[model samples]
Every structure is written in structure tokens, then in C-alpha cells.
Target: MTLTQDQRSLLTAIAQPWIDTSEWPLWANVQHQFDMRGQDADAIFHSLPRVGNEVSFASGYGYAAPMRAPIDPGHMVRLTVAGVSKLPRMRIAVGEPFMHTLRHMIDLYTRRPILVDEVPKTILRSGELTAALPKLDPWFVKVLPDLLSYEPAINTGGGAHLSDGSWEREVTRSVMQFRGMHTVEEYIEKTCEIVTKNAAQTAPFTIEEEQPMPTEPERAPYVDLALLDDLQKAAANTHWKVHKLIALCQGLNDAYKAGNPYVCAAMIRAVMDHIPPVFGHKDFKVVANQHTFMTQRTDKIHALKLVDFKDISDDGMHRQIGSSVPVLTMDNIPQPIRLNAMLQELLTILRKEAAIAP
Candidate 1:
């Protein structure tokens, strides 16, 4: 079967690392194996034109040549197009001993759940069935051996020693073994003690026997209207630039309410840009242009030791902003939520400054 993009990616990730660190003796052994088979080992495995210091995997069918170079170390070996074609045969000849290491390395890199169906055809064809079997979920254990077996199907009729009834009994026994040693009741009883012990240990320190249900406080508005009103009044006596800052604050609130955090992040950066002048920095524009100034300002706000707000701001300014893709997505709700909190804290700081302005 033609490999899927994901399967190819996983295979490349597994192979490249192994080839890089493998000793010269391993390649030599592979060369020797191909030579014995009366094959031009170098032409198949190493005939791929080396562009620079790296060696390609010869056949461009499996992986991209330069982008995903198989061999990292500069070396000349017998790896050519024909040798590459015989890779599956070579792996099979090496058997489970070598494939075990490859399987383990693949498992380490691809931490996602692997299925029997997902095992690449190359792995299956490599005669490492036993090594590859355990990589699948335990449910496939009993059946895989039979499936991979080269033995002819037994004829149940014509006085065959292995009758249908005997085969059925064997299959039943194997299924039971696969399901595990304990029955449902036995397993539950065995595990229940540990569960009960853990629950008791983690029970609340002061549980009230008849406590009234606590009502949740009213949901606060994203923008604090009263605080904004106070700041507006306070800013009237200060510089006119604070009005632009206040407008940005309102935009930030609107972005949060609309669930568009990318816009909210832009607004936050805008607010930061406006902040330096308000704090009496003589060369606020010039200082703000420097990357270090932004980090220093973030650090100053973080040093306020506010309630985990620093963490939110730090994550926003550092991690989230640095990401190539937008941080606000269904899979990454926390990033946007954290940014919202950071924005609120920043607005609070600005509001406080406006309130105390001369």
C-alpha cells in the first residue's frame, strides 16, 4: 500500500536519526550482505549525487532528498538506488535483532497511539513480525501470529487431526489469555481497595456536614466601567495622549468579548507602545524601537509580583507572540484566556496611573 504523508514523515524521522548515529561497521555489514547477493551495493545505496556534505537516500520516492537528508555525516558508502530498493530485504535478512532498535526509536519519536493498520508495509515486509507485533495494542496479539504465519490453512474435513472443534477451543483459550488472568469481578475487587485508599487520603481537610450551597458571584464585565469612568475623569486633567490609550483599552475589551484574541494581542502591543511616554521617558519613541526595551518593560511589570498576571504577560509577550501561527484556536483556548487576563492587568495599571495623574 502507498504510504500516507504521516506514515512517510514518521518513517523518515525514525530512519534519519538511526543512520546518523549508526557506526561504519553497520553500513559495511549491509554492503557485505548486498555484495553476497550479487548486487551492486554502492549503485543502489550510495549513487545518489551528494550536493554538499550530506548523502541522500538515493530514491526520491520515499522522502524529499535535500529537505529531509537521510545521512547527516559526510560519508561515501555503497548506498545506491538498487541498494535502496533492497532495503526491505536487507532489513529482513538482519531480522528482529536490528529491527528491535528501529522499532523502539520510532516509538520514542512518535508518542501518539499506534495501530496495527498504521504499521508501515516496509516494517511488515522486513520479516520483523515478532518485533513489530508488540508495537500494536495487545488486542491484536493472538491473531497477528496466525495472520503473519506462512503455514497453509488446516483442512478440518477428511479426518484431519486438527478438527474444527479443536481449533475453536484453542481460539477460545487464546482470547481468554489475551483478556488477562483476572475475571471482571476479581479485577474490580483487586483495584477497588487502591481507589478507596486514594480517595480517603485526598478527602477535604474540613468537610462540613450540612453546609449551604455557595452562590457564585455575578459575572464581572470584561471592561470595568466604573474604573474606566474614574480614569476618564482623571485623564481630563493630564496629557491628551491618555485618551488614545483609553480608546485602545476599550478596543481590547471589545476584542476579548468578541473572542478574537489575535486583535487583542495587537491592541496590547499598541498599549505598550503608548505607555513609555506616559511614564516620562524622554526618548520614549526611540527606546520603544529597541527590542530590549520591550523585554525590560515586561520584566518591570512582572516584578510587581501581582497574582500570576506576570506569567500571563510573559507567556503572551514571549511564547504566544513568537509562534508562527495564530495562538487563539479551539485547541489552544488557554493561550487566549491568558492573554485576556494579561490585557486586563495592563489596563488596570494604566487606569491606576490615570487616576493618580497630576
Candidate 2:
């Protein structure tokens, strides 16, 4: 009953009669529903099958070239039961699960699976349930003098298969006719029952397969992960505004491993220019000369001045000359450990500044 816009869109599209198997209209419907660009939908629709226990796609039919998860809308595509279970998580008009209220209720009230008797109390307190009730059990004109006009799950006879593979044997709403449909209480209980499994499981490959398994080649980190992680955490907290200092430090490390000495030097100089504000200095040279933090770290300070690295960065950036042996190499850059220590100290000062603020 409760569904996200995407979930609603999914349900609405599928609930329509199977007579319209036209591919472009269905795909166009998907595009209009999601409100994304055409270029992105090409990749996004193809990828939905990759989402576990949610959206799925049909496979190619012919014998010549078999494929999995083909998005040809003419072929039937169905929702998995985990997708149905998530209906309770959606709040009527709101697209997000605020607290997953039913799950929270279950977690609080029962150590075991909820009984049909326990459902009424659980349903009344649920904000999503209340909002969804009116839409689901909407007042309708009498079709005849005796029969009541009613529709459950928006009148879709479409079935959602359980990700656990139990739907094949289970007597669920999917198999039930309109006359034998579940009551609201039974519906709630069964919704909880059918969706109790973890959805992360995937099918294992067998020896019968002909193609080699796809393997992604792993590359070692281009930077010290520890330093990168620390900077990334800091950057995450301060992301309301741009953080060029963090970006430069990350680029510096990446350039170091990639063996681009000119880039390393430029990044080093950029960090020196950019990071002085943390130390309350106008420039790195001034920070080196005046700031207590820089003065205290004797080795890093000495390395900055003695190596003439900043000037080399400027000359390479400004001068145009023949590249006989090139202007810079890894030897010209400051020691990685030394640079890391300096960045660590900058983070230390920034944290202290943040802590002391009112």
C-alpha cells in the first residue's frame, strides 16, 4: 500500500493489463517516472537487475545468442518478494523509510515471527499504515445491491516471487484469485513472513559454463591509505564548503605513486600555499618563519627551506625550456613520511580549533 515514487511507478506500470507489451512505451514510461536523462537511463535500466531481490528483467528468448537480464519490456519482468516486503517501509506520499516503523515494532514486540493476531496493534500505530489505509480501502460506488466494491494491492493480480525461492510451493497472494484474496490482517502477517531472508545470496557458477569468469585486476593504492582516510574523514565533515587543501593532499599522494614528479612538486607547493590558513599565517614561508606549529617541527620546517623545492615548482610551472632530462623527478619531492606528518599536524590543529569553538 505504501510505496516510494519509484516503487509506485514500478507498481503502477506493472498493474496495467498485459495487452500493452510494446517495448518503447514501457521504457518511455520508466524514463518519465524516474525523471532522469536519456543517456543515464540506458545504463540505469540495465543495472536494476543487478539490484538484489528488487527489480528484475527478462532474458533474451532465441536460441542463437542467450543473455540474462534483457530489458526488453515485451518480455515479462517481475518484482521479488523482498520488494513487496519493503512496501511497509514506504510512508504514503513520502518516498523514504523514516524509521522502518513496522520492523521497529516487530523488533520491540516479538523475538519470533509476528502472529496474525499481533498485526492489528502493529498496523494502527504505524504512520505508513494509517496513510495507506484510505487509498487501499477507498470508498467506491456499489457494483450491485449485495456485493461490496473493493480492491487490494491496487487491484494488481501480478505476482512477486520470493527471493528465497519459496513462492513456487507457497500459497501466497500471487496464486490467489480475487475471491480468495487475503484479509488485511493476513496480508500484513504474510508480508512479514515471506520476506525474512537475507537478499545478498547469489547463484554460484558451474563447470558447464563456457566463458571464463570475469576478473577485475586490482591495483595497489596510489597513496598512503591511512593518511588518505584521515583526510577523507575530515573532508567529509567539512563538505558544506569546498576543501581544496584535502584534494591537493590526495592529489599529491596519487602523483607520488604514479611517478609524476612535476605534479608532485606542484601539489606540494599548492598544499604549502593552501594550508597556511589553518596555522593562522598568510603564506607557507611566513608560516615557516612565524607560526609556533611550524617552528616546533624542526625537521619538516628545515626540509621545506633547505630542499629549494618550492622554487623548483615555480620554475617548472613558469619556465619554457627544452626537455633534455626533464626538470623534476621523485628525488626533488619531499619525503612522503615528512609530508604526511605535516598534514597530520595540520589536522591536529584544525581539530583543536573545532573543539575549542563555542
Candidate 3:
């Protein structure tokens, strides 16, 4: 009997344990043993699970037929085992029913689950998985890794207000430090435009004052120290925290590279807001707040110190402050936060003045 192509493949796989390419001598003996039957046998095969009697086999070298289903599509049976002499010699009986069963089984096995896409959603909220996420902030629903919560060093360039509503940007990086002065100037100008464009949303102002307290009692502040402590503990984990800090820092670097001042500020603000109050260390606060002002262009630039914003009444309106505001310096700012201390202190002064207003 002559075997069909599929049958031949199936038979070869079954006979792999005994007869194979390397066992030419054994194969010759098996062929001779089979030739004794005095008939050319034809066999059939399919990419499906197989059942008994329909497939028959014979081998002098103890080649075992595929007794079980192949676990994966990639696995193919070899015609021989490592030590062929120790294995039982075998012969297979191939027939029509085996091919039919295999075809049917393969057809059924090919279909995948219907809801594979929705499977991930089920696992995403699993208790074990949720435990890995950072503790959620009460104010906002975000769980960023702790390391990303740390601040990176940033430098904000200064600019001067023009007669128009626009501000002329001064290169913020050190003069000797700038690789190309003209290019840096252009970048600063672009940054100023981006900041001014978003100024309405991120309105910078000196807090004037709060309305005087009413006689009616306000709610007692419920200081959630326990919650804060838990979040702080989570923030200390290197994998959880460091990754977010690196990602945010990299994002800022990319935004600056893209010449997107607004994006830089927006990204910094996002980070600042995301950080849980638990990790409110001085360095983190300074970095976040400083970067915020820099990106927003709310703070003063040394190069533009002489520009009179009062006379121009242009974009650099903050420079227009009157004598009522004290000269702001490092000494004037609160020691707790140094990033935007001068600007913040100035705002505090302005607030005091406003509070005293009749």
C-alpha cells in the first residue's frame, strides 16, 4: 500500500522513535521487514487529533507511533529516539477512520476563545494586581510610581515685556553656557509665546487675601496622617517610585527639546499634582514648584531686571509692581521652599496689602 502525503507525515512522526535519518541501518531493516508483506501500502494524515485502529504501524527498530496529541503546532515528531536499541519495535495500521477523526479534531481546535480581548480587563482589577498600584490620592485618582515623584534640576530663562502684549525672551541658560546664543534666544521667544498662550488657564497672581472668618464654626480639619503614612511608605519602593520620576523627567526633557514650553509646564504641573502629600519633602517641593514657575514664565529673569513693565504695561505685567511690594530676594523667601521663594514671597506681600485694603 502506498501512503498519501499526510499519511506519510503522520507515519513518519509515529515511527520517529525507532526509524529516522540518523538510523539508516535500522531504517533498512524496518523497510526489509515491511517489504516482507509483499504490498505497497497507502496511508493518510491530517493536522488533527488521531484515534485508534484506522492508523496502523510496523517497525523493526521499535519506533513508537505518536501515542498522544502534539501539545503545540510547532512540535513535530522525529522518527527516532536517542537510544533506539532500548525501545520497542512497532508497526502501524493506517486506515480511513483515523484521517477522518484527525481532520474533525483539528478543525475544532483551531477556533480560539470568543472573549480573549475582555480577559485582560478582568485581571486588571484583581486584588493581587491592584495591590501593586500606588495608593490613590484622596484629591485625585492617580497611582504614579514613587521615583517619578522626585524632582529633576531645571533652569528657567528670563524675558522682557514689549510695548505689545508679547514678551521678548532672554536666553535662560548661562550666556557662556549657551551653545548658540541666537538659537537659544529663538527658543526662549518660542517658550514665551507658548507660556503666554496658556497663561489664561494657569493664571499667576499674588494672593491678595482671604475673606475674614465668619463667626459660624468651620469644619474641623480631619488630618489623615494614617493615609499619608501609608502613601509615604509606598513611595519609598524603588521600582514603584523611581520609574515615574524618570518617566516624568524624560518627558520634560522631550517637551523642552520639542520647543514646547507649555507642554513642559503642563507636564511639571501634572507631576506636582500627582505626587501624594505623603512624600512632601523639601527637595521634591522645590523641584516641582520651581519647574512650574519656570514653565509658566511667572518668575523674574535677572537679564530683564531693568525693563519697566509699569511703563510698557505689556505681557511682563508682574514686573510692574509698585513700591508697596518689597524688593524680593533669597532672604525674603521662606526657607522651607526655595524653588520659587522670591516670587511666592512677593505674592505673600501683595496678599497682605490686599487684605488691608479698605
**Best candidate, lDDT-wise?**
2
Candidate 3 local distance difference test against the native: 0.29
Off by over 4 Å in 3: 1-240, 276-358
lDDT of 2 by residue, 103-146 (tens): 22233334334567673221112223335343332111010000
- Please give the clash total of every predicted structure, in order: 10, 0, 35
TM-score of every candidate = 0.24, 0.36, 0.16
lDDT winner, 2 or 3: 2
- Candidate 1 lDDT over 294-352, as tens digits, reads 23666334323232333443455466434473354322223333333334444455566
**Of the candidates numbered 1 and 2, which has the greater lDDT value?**
2
Q: What would the per-residue lDDT of candidate 3 be over residues 28-127, giving only the tens digit for each residue?
A: 3433343565532211222322222212211111122232332223223323221121223321211122122222223322332458557211111212
